[model samples]
Target: MSPAFSVLMPVYAGDDPSHLEAALRSVVDQSVRPDEIVIVEDGPLTDALSDVLDSYERAQGDHFSRYRLRENVGIGNALRVGVRRCEHELVARMDADDISVPDRFERQLAVFERRPDVDVVGGYIAEFDDDPDDCFACRIVPTNHTSIAARARFRNPMNHITVMARRRAILEAGNYRDFLGMEDYDLWVRMLSNEATFANVPSVLAKARIDRDYGQRGGLSVTKAEVRLQRSFYRSGFIDAPILLYNLLTRASVRLLPKRIRGRLITRYTRTPG
Candidate 1:
């Protein structure tokens, strides 16, 4: 018998309507179908989104569950609520804007079974240029826990959307917390502190939606990341001086460097053979 998996997803009030359906389809079409799908409607969603989710849930009937939040409690809270409501021993997280490949669950489940020491697993991601016309970026994560955590101080190895974790380990780590913008980062640190192991599957598991207007490399998101990185380093007491200096230099050169070039430099330096 295929092991049951629960997918916990949080959808904000203003998510792209089309993207939501694509996300839902990705899960429904997974090679190893999930036993339950929990969509936490974070805060009161838009009427259009609500209607769409309602229609989708009705179509699935008892195959899925939708947990609607009366008030906006942020992603961490929504995820916590979703986790509590899940019945399966394995929990996979899906983002409302990303598309999971059909074999993602099957591959992740195999990893979990093979590596009993690993408490969580994630995989490579194919990032699509959010532009209606052009393709932009794609990347893969390290497939080993030590390698991933070795670089964790610089950047997160696991894509939030592609994470699958053991329910017991997650609960023992105190689950997700309210960390403003870096909730996932905070949780990963906590899990590591608990000696919970993590790994990444070598295969591409999901497609991330990224656009020029997304402003991840520049603008407010970058600023938020800078603050969050400093805060995480302070809290973890594990940030390396070399990595810190390298990150600062990249941030300073953001305006002078091309996006792809800067991205490559950062990714390379952080994930360099160490």
Candidate 2:
């Protein structure tokens, strides 16, 4: 049986209203329409933002279900709140700023259909900038269970916002939690520990905005979050000391490399569509 889908998006204070419209449109325009669209306004959104959302909702008709958060909460908390309100068995994540391809939902659905045992499915992403020449290619996670678990002990393979997770499996893994900066990684580790399998679609399913503004918090926050994830996995008995130490060192080394080199590598790896 094909599982119904709930597309969940959490809106933060700094989101671009125009961008939000495009993101929402992608969901509404999906090849396989979701059963519900759950928008969680993380806090009191700006008037302009609210107006845009209002317009989008009116246009979407009965396709969407919106909610407003009376008090400001962090992204992790916002996501948890939104997911709880989902009425479907499959939860698809959409970021306020990212753009999903029109076929994103359809492609993800196919993956789930092919691998009924898989609990989550995501895909590759392309990084874009204002300058066309500055784009890079990246994969969110591995496309099969073997590779997924091979790299699972270290870094996050799936982009949280680009994933479609089995609702029941997510609940069994304890759902989203307040992991501060590394909520996605924390959740992935917990899911892995529970023996949940993950896979990514081979095609690029979305575009991720990666710019200078993203790492502003000294990048220490992300690093710290990874450490917390490591602690979680260690405590869960999923990984021992040697493997954890190796992953930490390897991940740190990759981050230490220059951005120019990283960008070049990423660009070189991805093929330009004809």
Candidate 3:
């Protein structure tokens, strides 16, 4: 039998109620469903979202759990709390708006079963706008440790929402910390620094939601955060001076482009590499 696991999801006011419902359904109805679903309400939610939670609570009963924060904390902080509260040794991360394929959990767990040395496992994601059936792009990452670590030098090597990690490993690596947009990347770098084993199943495990504006790079604050993250990468020894300078220049130049052109460039960079 598969070991028991928990799914940790963080949702805030910005998440759509309908999308939340779909995400929950995907978890409970998975081909190999998790024994526990831990949802962290990042802040007080809208009545619509609360109502959706109410319905699920009634239907899911003991299998479902909710923890609400008095105020808004970012995903990293919300996950830090939920990770500790989880009862199982294996924890899967999911986004409030994305939909998982039915066998996602089963496939990922199989990786752990086969390779007990792996501390974390992730998979590819297909990006969809209004309809999942019409995924226009996919983000593919390396499937083995050497390639994954090498990819980390320049980019995020795993899709955050499709990750399943050993609870002990995550905690030992200092749990999660708040970062503007690169929290998972930050955590991965620390895990790498600690010599944690990693792998990815070679498949699209989830259909991630996206919008027209998803590709648009943010303003000054976002760029600053990117620069800050690259610096963190440098200090962590994931990248050196030259890689850092190249990343900053390419990122800053792209952010200065017209919105449409920037969006196109970002989307292209996000797709499966040639």
Give the total clashing residue pairs for model 3. 0
Alpha carbon deviation, residue 232, candidate 2 (Å)? 1.1
Candidate 1, pairs of clashing residues: none
| Candidate 1 segments exceeding 4 Å error | 130-135, 217-229, 240-274
Candidate 2 TM-score, C-alpha based: 0.86
Q: What's the lDDT of the predicted structure labeled candidate 3?
A: 0.89
Q: Residue 185 CA error for candidate 2 (Å)?
A: 1.5
Give per-residue CA lDDT, model 3, range 1-274, as digits (tens). 9989999999899999999999989888899989899989999999999999899888888988999999999888999999998989999999989999999999999999999999999999998888878887888999999999998887789999999999999999999988776789889988988899999999999988886446655677767778888898888777899999988898755656677787677677778531
- Model 2 per-residue lDDT at 205: 83
Please give, for residues 1-274, the per-residue lDDT of candidate 2 as tens digits.
4568999999977999877877887788888888889999999989878987899788777767788889888888988888888998899998888888889999898888888898999887766654323555454557888887777776677877689998888888888988765677778878887889998888778886666222212245655765666777877887899977886775544444466654444445423421
Top-lDDT structure, candidate number: 3
| Number of the candidate with higher TM-score, 1 or 2 | 2
Q: How far is candidate 2 from the true structure (C-alpha RMSD, Å)?
A: 3.4
Q: How far is candidate 1 from the true structure (C-alpha RMSD, Å)?
A: 4.1
TM-score of each: 0.83, 0.86, 0.95
User: Using alpha carbons, what is the TM-score of model 1?
Assistant: 0.83
